[model samples]
Target: MPLSSAPISAPIARQGDGADPYAWLQARDEAEVLDYLKAENAWQEQQLADQAGLRETLFQEIKARILETDLSLPSPWGPYLYYTRTTAGDEYPRHYRCPRPVDGSHEADEAREQLLLDPNELADGGFLSLGAFSISPDHQRLAYSLDTSGEEVYRLFVKDLDSGQIHSLPFEDCDGSMTWANDSQTLFFAELDDTHRPYKLYRHRLGEEAAHEVFCEPDGRFFLSCLRSSSERQLILQLGSKTTGEVWVLDAEQPQQPFTCLAPRVEGHEYDVDHGLLEGVWTWFIRSNQDGINFALYHAPQTDHSVPTRADWQPLVAHSDTVMLDGVTFNARAITLSLREGGLPVIEVRPQGLPAYRVQLPDAAYSLYVQDSLEFDSDRIRLRYQSLNRPAQVRQLLLDSGEQRVLKQTPVLGEFDADAYVSQRLWATAADGTQVPISLVMRRDRQGLPAPLYLYGYGAYGASLDPWFSHARLSLLDRGVAFAIAHVRGGGELGEAWYRAGKQEHKHNTFDDFIACAEHLIAQGVTRAEQLVISGGSAGGLLIGAVLNQRPELFKAAIAEVPFVDVLNTMLDPDLPLTVTEYDEWGNPQEPEVHARIKGYAPYENVRAQAYPATLVIAGYNDSRVQYWEAAKWVAKLRTHKTDDNLLLLKTELDAGHGGMSGRYQGLRDVALEYGFVFKVLGLAL
Candidate 1:
């Protein structure tokens, strides 16, 4: 089936000022919108119908690299060793546990296995996602939340582990988060309002007929969440927005008491608290941005339950303009601080009264994350480390002895070798003379040739895109392609100042930085204009759309997934989900200046008569973040105005949300589809 050559008709203009021509597409369930999406789906399928064999080969290549049957490292919690395992054909993992031995051995006893939950059995034939899974303090009961739809609203369920019976709680519109009390009978959860914002906290007893609403946030800008402290002595409730937040604490031993505020929320002041013992004193470690753009660590005594102001905060670690304080975790013997400096993550461990030291890593460009510690009193801490060319390795570090051991290194099946690949960190100078970081990885055999290059970027909301391993990307590298990541300014790679320079009035820096990186790669002879392809998703999708409009002749192809291209219209509507809360990230368009700024760059508003490279745009019908209409409207406008007939395709997943299709095998198939499209455009062999 050939795609229709007749261009889509121009959208019908509305009577209001700045009215969108394609605003009618926003009616998701309307017949016309559904018809248009179905047509696009059919066209995409027809265009790639000849590559069915290649898609299958790519899928199998990715599947072969993963271990079908695997077990995660068991972490000791209470009297049991808890872990999850996946079977060969199952779509979800099964949660299991065994009694912890007195000898302190970290081995699972197969004969003593106890099954807590099996999602494969629960899901039946429909979509199922397991949300909050937590065990009671006594370890006799379990509370979990499940969402059968991809919309993210979940229902609560409790199970008696000893009796092997499950009871459904009479709660609706839950946000899928639960924190258990020390009594083992009470649980706290957050419930979403009509707009799908978590606005209320409720407490429920195991056998109660109705749950009690503990607190409700009156302010629409702030969202609520609940969690248990690491020490297991306090229940913490948090209310926060993009730039500010407040924390409240309740004594776990006294469930009847109301939560006390730790500190009142101040506009533009953000802080998070974790309880820990410092020098034998109960202390609160708060990571706050009150004194610096990049946060600082402050400590306060927990004895007086009164709210402490900024004046009472005593600095534990002063803020550094070069480093962004990410978070802090605690154990009885030490405190672990997660920080980002020079676009790389580093972990520092400080013993109760000793000096601090950083965790050692082999690669300059790699990603690191702290795993949950099972016990508060234990000295062992777990960390996950991975690089562009290396598989993930989970390590256990002892704070007392400074000893580290690798618990597991994810296996990459078949003849895979890390030595055959080369990964490097390169710098590109932006137009304003600021240095932008780029992480590149490629097969050693393709270094000198002018091969195809895949550049990826996302520079919004201070989110950092760190270097990590991807098994599916190997298919491209093996096909003589070089992959690179441009750590642009809107990201937190270079700290808060970097993010500030790329957002709001200075948003053009993001597009400028990306263009600079692409030119740098070409100047270095890594790839020429016709051999380059760029990709990004969500906000990054906005980046791809903006850059494509700015420099259409600079790349061969582009991919934008769930792109937020209709920014001006989205920000103008206050009734949309998450619109009010996102005013801090993207300026409020109700103001004339902000509206003009957004209109100047919004992809849907900027389409013109120009030739564009081959492009693939993806969307989900159920995506709440970026609506499906945004992509559909943008594609319609492009067809009407684009000067050249470059292959333009749109693929919409009917049953999925923001993230594509669910399940491991299904996700692999989606990647195969994307890789197949890229291969077809690049003229690569199957």
Candidate 2:
């Protein structure tokens, strides 16, 4: 069933004609509209009930399915130890202490069996849920932060491992990032006010009579610029201003003294400060409107009294074909550079005194993330790799010796056998000839007779959703439905070049990319227009809304989660926490050109009476990032404008923030709800 380019219905230029798409919709005055919404809501509630029932049955089925595979699963989790009280296998990894093998066996299952957390016989029992923890220089005491309530405020608590005694600092709110003072007698941490402003540095001594504020930045909007010295006696400050930032150096002992500015604020240039290995040597990455790219500067390695403002700073690298350095890791002899070159990742390990060595990973898919794991030392790096069907792989790479070992591999997906799973990378040219990357995944057993397909895309910011494997995604893979990702512009998948192609004025590329992906899927016998489903969350949800308006007949259903649909209006309101910070990301909507572009594509504002697909819009009640009302209004309008019979479901979570749940079973239940919808649409069993 190939789809043709011809319009499915006569084009009625106006939004609400008598033949208006929403002619059948029950308005607020109409009892049917309220009843219709009520009916759909009840149906969804029943679907949730069915999903819960299936979960109990599926858990056993999936457990058997997963264990039947040949892959090695990592004990299903890691260990957690806090002083004498140790507990591993909490619901979330961040909540518990990850236990390591005492003998460094690195066998997760064996280590789990050996490590034990004994229930204590004491009445006044307390457990330390480790947050950002650091060991003192002498290793006698350990300082860690833990969240007490709604806020992620760290309360500094010190534990004397030998005496099994814990002492609390005077401060109620402490910084997650804190380092011990040189003398080890004083502890330093930062604090933010109620307005979510950056931390002001404070110091606490073991026997101090009073807690002292060591330093504070003047503006509430600005953040702390404190960087500890090699001796920890002095602090380097990088004061952040609205437009730019300035660098300063201050003595720790002089609590209220003015800071000496090392680098004056550069107009239109965004600067970042990095403390170097040597004293007085700091690095700055500066991005400016004039330069059109970023540049790096290395300050003098040591403090020279005679030449305090020494221009001994050298230019290590300048903006070129590379978009910008994503991250930089420093070792004793070299600095490992991570940059996006033409949207692909390139890692360069340049020795300070020696030549640089470049290692390039294959570029067909995306790199989900590349982080230097603390488990390994300077010369060795642990990297996690992910792709469309390839579950994540953690590998350790040695820079000097050029040796690499696979530390861990995601369990082989039992639901999907590589031989039976088919995937392909296709490209579609937009109106501007920019080719969009589209990935499609299908089960070999699934026949191509208009089966339901689930497609996804995210084309905002330079955030690239690298192709990676996920075992959880197997829920969809096990079904006959196909899974897909649309690598549109605005994402860093191809790097800055691709991102620039889809942002602001050129934002149409994102919509076009999504539409193109859908068309390609239908054309390739994967699915028919009516059998396809598309989903995106946040900015990606914005994409879903745009395409639905343009081609509603193309999809069977849509899931827009925590979507940013009220783009045009939200951008104008600076009262939103991230709106001002996002001006550079999503253009200022006040600008004439930007205003017109956003108005044209803004999802909520552009709703029309058209034959639309069934839609499910989800939001979080406490979501400060994307307001709940945005989805509320969009659903309201969609109900009013739809031409034909279609279902629209709005689910709002009152329990959690941006991420839904804290418990493992709760999250699994959430996953089951979404997957159940797809299965029900595809006519699978409850």
Per-residue lDDT over 22-112 for candidate 2, one digit per residue giving the tens place of the 0 to 100 score: 3333133255443433444444565455567666555544443332323232321123222222223233232112355566444444333
Instruction: Judge candidate 2 at residue 630 and give its lDDT.
Output: 70
Error of 2 at 182 (Å): 5.0
The list of candidate 1 runs beyond 4 A from truth reads: 1-18, 304-309
lDDT for model 1 comes to 0.88
Predictions in order: lDDT: 0.88, 0.61
Candidate No. with top TM-score: 1
Native-to-model Cα distance after best TM-score fit, residue 611 in candidate 1, in Å? 1.2
* Steric clashes per prediction: 0, 14
Model 1: per-residue Cα lDDT over 267-347, one tens digit each? 999998888788888888789998898999999877755656567789998999888898888998998889998889989
Best by lDDT: 1
RMSD of 1: 2.6
